[model samples]
Target: MSSNALDQFLNENLEDLRSKGLYNEIDVVESANGPVIKIGGKELINLSSNNYLGLATDELLKEVAINAINEWGVGAGAVRTINGTLDIHTQLEKTLAKFKGTEAAIAYQSGFNCNMAAISAVMDKNDAILSDELNHASIIDGCRLSKAKIIRVNHSDMDDLRKKAKEAKESGLYNKIMVITDGVFSMDGDIANLPGIIEIAEEFDLITYVDDAHGSGVTGKGAGTVKHFGLADKVDFQIGTLSKAIGVVGGYVAGKKNLIDWLKVRSRPFLFSTAVTPADAVAATKAIEILMSSTELNDRLWENGNYLKNGLKQLGFNIGESETPITPCIIGEEKTTQLFSKRLYEEGVYAKSIVFPTVPQGTGRVRNMPTAAHTKEMLDQAISIYEKVGKEMGLI
Candidate 1:
């Protein structure tokens, strides 16, 4: 093939992304990711990140990663099925199971891959998956890969979930039925009704899957949404990421030993991909230890969250209903939302705007992630910027 073919393919896709306004231009962070970050030679209060507990730059986690790197080289050599299952991997899985209050756990290279691996491993063409309309993209892809019949219920509408579950069960169109939802909806920060989901699952005998990517280290006093609702035992699969709050890279599925065992033997990712680095495994384990030691970080995180949320609401910005730290300043137009974020950035705040297809049209907004590391002064400054931007944009 001619080299022009590759160039043509790239140019066409790049043009399409630009036309859609979804071609995100990369911004270089000049300093460590934290409450305050240096970008474009300007220091700004960072409101766009997933480092909830601020452990991404924590000294403890750094030390653990360093020590682990010193002890065991860098990569894990091969797939877990071959020789990549290191002792640290097993230790991390055990620690995760204990942290999530589950009987067993399995780890994957990335949270995204965890969904790709676990969902396909258990459910297939003959299965039916009842998912929330707003579930994460990873979950949607996982369901598609499973070749299962996917039925989306209204966001947090337990009645719809129940009706669908009952219908799927009675129809006998599937060999198995499963319910999947995000423990915390990332966009709105609204928590899933796990208790209601469990009730429906029990009534319908459906498998329960909770993806707590945004909930872990932020809810349930740091354990996650399942623990928040005391459904750790009731939920069949408790999915989580080690990257966000755990300050490392990888994903996990916590559930009964049988489910994990089945995944270990069948999940293609685990069988084909190399395990996480020793440093990542050790750092994640250390992060979990910190979470288990006390709720101090979790409390501080919420404190910062509430402080920022209250300030934003008081500033007359239409922040939607959110029970978690993920706050969105609802600016209802795509261009306006993007402009609001740009204005805020110019004013020394680094919050990014999320627009259509990340969310429904006309519900675009700038999402703020307040971490435990944010000081009161930092939040106040952010509030001031929001007020100025809101006034300038006539969004107030």
Candidate 2:
């Protein structure tokens, strides 16, 4: 029989989560994840995907992916350090370096693995990492895996970062210190102050790392956050995901050639884990080429974002401070936020509610992600549904 202790622990925690309205119930989409999705035989205006530029469903990308499958087959069949390093993989890395304005780059199977691989490869128990409190969960796990002394700094507070950096340096207890942050805070959707952070990094001689998973295609004219602030040569580690804006799978680190070389040798994930599929590599390369060639998709994305934000604001909803396209409509309680999302689903919109644990308590919200693929007509329909649901629930 299965272990009773383990089963009991899971059952109790699952029950607790359900009772508190914190447990998430995932929905399956029958159709492609595009501007609209089919869930349980009902169509919805999908405003909850990370497919920012809508390249996931682009005809060009789909064609390239099919070509790649025909040419390279499906899988790489080995870890990167083994025989998995295909020419397309190298091409993808080179394109990523150019796209991010970096000297060289390396690829990983997932953005989470990029962190899990890169951070531990560079840091150790002898080192320390100063991280923003609002950074992504992947970042937190990566820092933990490093076995470094993880020091939490106040979110986007330059003074607190400087103070902590100074203290960590002055104590001389650690051999190296790294300050890591997200280029875009995903939940609240604010850009990171890279210039300020770089200034402090210079003063402290600390390594700088920016995970621009949410900022890459949406910011910097589609180059990324590092290039957005013209600090391309200043930052040490630039991390991004191919799945989000690139509309494929995998992640990468763009930096100096030596750093990438070192990671290829030392990063456990690269040495042990299999690389991304050939189709993913080829599709991502084509996506980056599209972004670097033009900003049409990026512009359309911003227009849709602004249109939706204005619609929600005019209808009397609290959208938190978001400089980027990610918009969150704040609902005070967990249950209420869940109810709001449910009502939205019933009204043919598909934005999900983020509750406590993902965010702080009493600050739950239904996050909306508008894509380049969404037309003005689709956005208008979504806004009308939001208004209908909001008024019925007394939210607006």
Candidate 3:
């Protein structure tokens, strides 16, 4: 009587997930997600957030957000195409272009939406996208929405990318070809070889896009991976997030003035969705300003990252070969990965396990994100707990 078909479908899917041990129970955070987090009244050392520079809890950002709320109120009231494009929004875009060393920029409600808007804005069924096998989910979705012919390139393999680029160009099956990659892959924390990618793009005349979500505040002295390699002008579409590292909520695309203008007119999300709150725009602007003004927070983040990576490696856990601070303590089976993370949680650490299909099967790992905010004392306690748990589970 009460939607029996929908109920059956949901019940079957839920049952299948549980039976396969793929179901996850979301935890409730009882406090701020800082270097440490409180959940179920237990304070645990937090290594899971993407808040790299600890800007989310910084006093300066908070004060600026509060001031913006007082001055501009909360909501943007409408989409950017209508009446939502405020002065602060324009300021944020200008500041972001400066940060990325680009001619202009445009903002979206969130990073995921930025992808959805930017990709579909320019690409269509006649176009093609050469994507990294390890690119983020948002990029994958964006490529799909574009209706472009998607060709997966091997991870960080310049030769493979080049071969595919040549093949795609010669196939004569597409109008425009865009090669997309994540500036810093989130799971392993390895940065994309932007220089290698740019060389190929130049040779093949491919539009280059880099999603610098993880790399923006964490790499290139807080500018990003594209700038890290000095290819800011060479790259085509530079996508970033206001949430991660910037410590607020929003997304943006920075590029040539013409491209941004096209996006402003054509990107569906920017056209349809309401703009971000004034507080978000101003707070993100302030955070970017802090990053541009100094590298103190960036230094701290790298130092903390190195400390965590060294501690885990010395303890004999197989933290994979990572170029950045992201550490993954591999524990093969899915159930073991989940159990290891649960023990870490109970032991005062709160790293989470990533399993298939987020990653390949039998390569399940408990990933760690050491931030600038984590003190030496907190890191030491976490490492000691890792040692205790590793021995208990015979993982070391």
Model 2 residue 38 distance off true place after TM-score fit, in angstroms: 0.3
Ten consecutive residues with minimal summed lDDT in candidate 1? 17-26
- How close is every model to the real structure, measured as TM-score? 0.97, 0.99, 0.99
Q: What is the per-residue lDDT of model 2 for residues 55-161, given as tens digits with 9 covering 90 to 100?
A: 99999999999999998899998998879999999999999999999899999999999999899999999999999999999999999999999999999999999
C-alpha positional error of residue 240 in candidate 2 after TM-score superposition, expressed in Å: 0.2
lDDT of each: 0.93, 0.95, 0.93
In model 2, the worst 10-residue window by lDDT is 73-82
Among these predictions, the greatest lDDT belongs to 2
Deviation from native of the Cα of residue 315 in model 2, angstroms: 1.2
| lDDT measured at residue 40 in model 1 versus the true structure, 0 to 100 | 91
TM-score of 3: 0.99
The alpha-carbon root-mean-square deviation between model 1 and the true structure, to one decimal in Å, is 1.5
Q: lDDT per residue, candidate 1, 164-218, as tens digits?
A: 9999999989999999999999999999998899999999999999999999999
Per-residue lDDT for 212-279 in model 3, tens only? 99999989999999989999889999999999999999999999999999998999999889999999
* Among all candidates shown, the one with the greatest TM-score: 2
Candidate 2 lDDT: 0.95
Candidate 2 regions exceeding 4 Å error are none
Which has the better TM-score: candidate 1, or candidate 2? 2
